[model samples]
Target: MHSYAAVLRTPHALSTFGAALLGRLSYGTVSLSLALSAKNASGSLAVAGTALALFGATSVVLSPVRAALVDRYGPRRALVPMAVVYAALLTVFALVTRDHPGAGTSAVTLGALAVCAGACTPPLGPTMRTLWSQLMPDRRMLQRAYSLDGVAEELLLVAGPLLVGVLVAYAEPAAGVAVSAALVLVGTVALALSPVPFPVRRGSGRRGSARRERTTRTRPRGLMQPVLAAAGVGLCLGGLDLLAIAFTERQHQPGAVAWVLAALSAGSAVGGLTYGAVSWRSAARPRLALICAALGVALAAAGLAPNVYALGAAAAVAGLFVAPALTTAYLIADEAAAPDARTQAGAWVNTALNAGISGGTALVGVLVGTLPLFLCFVLVAVPALVCAAVTLHGENHRKRH
Candidate 1:
């Protein structure tokens, strides 16, 4: 009996680990796939930027709707249809983008395809985390699980681009897109059907979120506080990402771009581990917000560095805050979410972050082609500083509350 029990547990553990890995891989591939597509087809940085920005913007608008469906219909049910549509869109993107002539019409078509693809794939992190929170429920386990989730996110961000770069450099850019779609198909399907963990809320009136929604309705100004703060911070982070992109391209060092971004992500993985390991007894919001603000200022300074080496160093320091800020913001949202709006809160976080990134990219792309690289950094830094100031304000508000 004991041996059989141990054998059963091993498969479950492996399943969970596999699901986590696949989810992160799927999440991380989007950027690499887009970058490869734009670079290969259009051969223009501006076109690449357009693809990335459009994808992010579409995801921002689309993720909330997907989350709502996931909440109501269950992730498994939602994932089945979404995965099929998403894969089909990627197929079209890869095929059409391969031989595309660099023209205004091609750019528009590519951008439209990216948006459709982005909107279709539900935001994986929120859905995965929500499912984890249900499956693991013990506060300690949940904390560790979330940290691992963040680390997986960072890992995917690092690995996905590097892998796609290799595939593109060795075979062809179209190959990278094909591989990404295949992985998304395989991994997303695995995630949906994996029986080790189940949905957090099955839309049951007597059992789940309906009751909680009613109670949360009476709690102050509701979702306004956390949602606004999250969006503001997201805008700052997005600006930083764009600055990095512009800096790399302006330096005439396209190869270095992925490496620098990977370094920053690696730093965040370390930070997520650190945050998850620590056991704080009370709400760590004020302290976390302060830390995140300082991190933002530090990152902005990295942008001002004269050379790539110095910039990478600065980015590393800034990267330290990425996971912490993300984890903290998500934590705040979880605590403050209305019952009916809990899923929406997660979607808002996704949208806010993507919106911030898209906004920053669009704004920076205009100046990047015309200005000095360092100047672009300075421009990007301004928004980061603004974000830090907003976070500081949040800290003060929290103290009063």
Candidate 2:
């Protein structure tokens, strides 16, 4: 608690944290909002799914570029305008879909608009982690901050959909999208104005040569290992979501799907907070491997669960390892990246995660009807365990080198 307090006590930390979190909350809404809007407009689930997939694909493609821009320019310069543009695009999408319901051209335009929004979407998650590193340079406090971040992400994942659902139910799907845009615009603007000192391009100075040497020294190697590992984590998460839904539906408790999924997120949030509070003596990489392995085992158990309640319990246990694994993955990526390229490095993790989710969701969709739910869970575990083994191998190879 004291460690977490230390991070909070940093000047402007609360404001920046709040803004970043609010900005990220927008992420949770966008997919659902787009899907709902497209479905309403086109009267087709297929169109909705395609729009959502295009959005995710665009985001995965553009994340690293956005992060690199943040690295080159200050966050304010890079993020503020992008946020405004992204919000405007969201508004445009909502209005276009609403006004031209069932128009094929509107769907195409919405897809194009989604692509633009993806390009302009502020990299809030990576940027916040970077800000935490800068504000709380102490390793323990930084770990806590990262854990808090992971927990917040889990919360957003749970809440974002709920919020969108409520809005769409009470008003319309376009309203949910508009609110999502508003959150992104307002939150990002506040964060941009916060008094955090972000990194900028190198300037000509007498100490330039020393700075250059330091940059070279801190340059990261073997970055692909961490990126791939993060993706595997995402794959497991995405697969779990689909499997949980299927499990609940099989039990004739489709309504309980939300609660079961919430159990997973709730468990993850608690676990993240606990993991952050502890002081660990082990190196991050090996710990990452162990956590990944644990996640696979727990998820495999979830597959074998005989009842919905049992599956939920197993999922909670699986959730316990999620934040720790992700936090460690982020730390590893930071350590492996060049100081100058840290933002982009973190973005790579984000990209991999998005890609993994997209892949996992698509894969599970194809197999949902054909395969048993238990078998699906086991299949999902394979990527996670593979990632763990690969991480162990990479670490060993590095030692040998």
Candidate 3:
């Protein structure tokens, strides 16, 4: 296949991709929806914030565990039950918010529901990537598929909040929650039915995801390269979000923060697609380290921008490496794992990225208020440079031994 079109033309590609995006879209919606629903029902920002935090805590922390289920059982068996139960909990949560007024709902009850709902959050993104690994054995084609997947995901996250904003204008925030439930339920069912991940018979002359799952002796140590790289990117992004807002405020153009941040996402989208379109001869592991280093350099330079326009441009430049870094990391992680553990491997990267994002946000929040923005940006970039140096140096050290 010479183009992305050819990659999409592969069997079961469109159906599975569509289903995965639909299910993944729920994640984009649920955050805002849950936050709004909690606030409206509880009428206490503290309660609402606590509920959302608890939800995120369980969802992000338990991601790999859920992915492990997909690996242990099968996507069909593991995903269906998780989606159904997750959807049910979301529906019940919506209803609880709808029925209860301020003080009518106990804080404990809402917090528990949020935690439970998050715990069952299906691992759609990781599963879809695993399906991609199964569908495209050609390294080049798989890269295209991942780039397509990553860009679409970026768009969905942007679109999800806009959708919730529109939805809440017509109805309660709970309506958004209900819609999220429906989306996941329908999407998960379709994905589980897609033609992928069948266990291949021995001597079938084709590799299968399930064929590797039945084995126990698989080295997951190679996972560190991508995981660390992903964490570095996530930390950079998380800190950048806050830094952008601070910059805009200082410039007296607080409204520009939206487009400034949009610039970041735009850069990532273009970078991801362009990365997929290119055919690289280098291995993904080394490519990931280099991209992370490039991202760090871009971000470090961003702090030195003289004005808002320059800052936005620097951010866009930094964004260029963002998607490529993550896409390459995914490729490396996928290659590191046995077929059965592919989902788990991908989930670990996902978890690290999300955790890094959360940590970066918190860490930057503290730093931005006290330190100069320039210093903050430099601090955030350190993670990426260190992670990159560590990975590359380890590889070099191993070569000499």
Candidate 4:
């Protein structure tokens, strides 16, 4: 493992890592903050869920448009306004949601504002992946960079929510969102000033190619393919998130919710380290995804277990696949994107994945009042199996094509 000191020793690494850390921290704090805020405002899980869903759904819906702006105007130009807008919206959310736990009208308005703000901020995942593609010298080094990033992200998600929970317990629920906004503003400005803003490569060999060239461009489609797969994976993840929430609430220990979620995040950290150590030498990768499939199935079983320990054990298995699957998806996507569209392409995949998760959450949330928790597990597992099947199909398709 790279030490913190080693990562910070260079200006380039520090900038990239700082941007990634802040972005994840901003994103991770939303769930806990929204949940706490909504609960405080309306005294209902339903309202809290709505606020969270709005933020996610809005972000997904707006991502493509934001990407378009980035393509036309350049990321540096597009980033500033978006970041400012997102920060403003989050601040509004903090103030409005603080004093109105059950004010239906206020909550609804704040949710809308929050969602719009959330959507405007271009996803940092794609930008960071694009940075990885450009800044790193080689695959081995890039893999390490991404692996370290995965660890940092997991830590952010783990620590961010826990911090929010602690704040809610001692001070106020709204502090979480405020902190998120402050971090986003600070980190985004730093990213904008960094030398990595410029694209390392730009051209399209297929720009004016014949039909055959377009068909076999091996660029844009490769990028889109991961988005498709990531969306499917997102669906499963969305369900898992809702399952975790409902299950934790049922356990009468809502405060321990982060730990339950962290089980999966912890598993991802371990899996990322393992994946970084291996070399996947092709775009037609299925082995790692197959492992993810098995993990999802195991997670479903864990969700149905009679106790928390058994549940955690199952979650560990499920979590183990998280990083490897993501790593493979990203590697293939990067290999496939047009030079000019790399960041946009990566962001689209992320958008698709997150959209799928949000959609899953909405679908599963609807099922919460009707279905048993075990049944919900079954429902969530079905999509994960589908993701696995599609990944396997991609493997076969690679062979035949």
After superposition, the stretches of candidate 1 with alpha carbons farther than 4 Å from their true spots are 1-14, 34-53, 97-112, 196-233, 241-260, 300-308, 338-342, 365-401
Q: Which segments of model 4 are wrong by more than 4 Å?
A: 1-11, 34-49, 97-108, 169-171, 200-220, 244-259, 281-284, 300-306, 365-379
Per TM-score, the best of the predicted structures is 3
How does model 3 fare in lDDT? 0.88
Superior candidate under TM-score, 2 versus 4: 2
* lDDT at 194, model 4: 67
Selected candidate, larger lDDT, 3 vs 4: 3
lDDT of 1 by residue, 1-401 (tens): 12212322444544755665775586666677777677678878788888877876677788878877776676578866887788788888888777654533377878888889888875567766666555554555556666666777767776887787777677767667777778777777777776755544444556556675664474334444445445555565666676777677767776776667767777788877777766667564564556556675776577577767777777777777777766766666665664334555667676777676667666776877788766666666565455556656766786799
Model 3 regions more than 4 Å off: 99-104, 198-218
C-alpha TM-scores of all predictions: 0.77, 0.92, 0.94, 0.81
Clashing pairs in 3: none
Question: How many residue pairs clash per model?
Answer: 0, 0, 0, 6
RMSD of each: 5.4, 2.8, 3.4, 4.2
* Model 2 residue pairs with clashes: none
Error of 2 at 211 (Å): 9.4
Which pairs clash (backbone N, Cα, C closer than 3 Å) in model 1? none
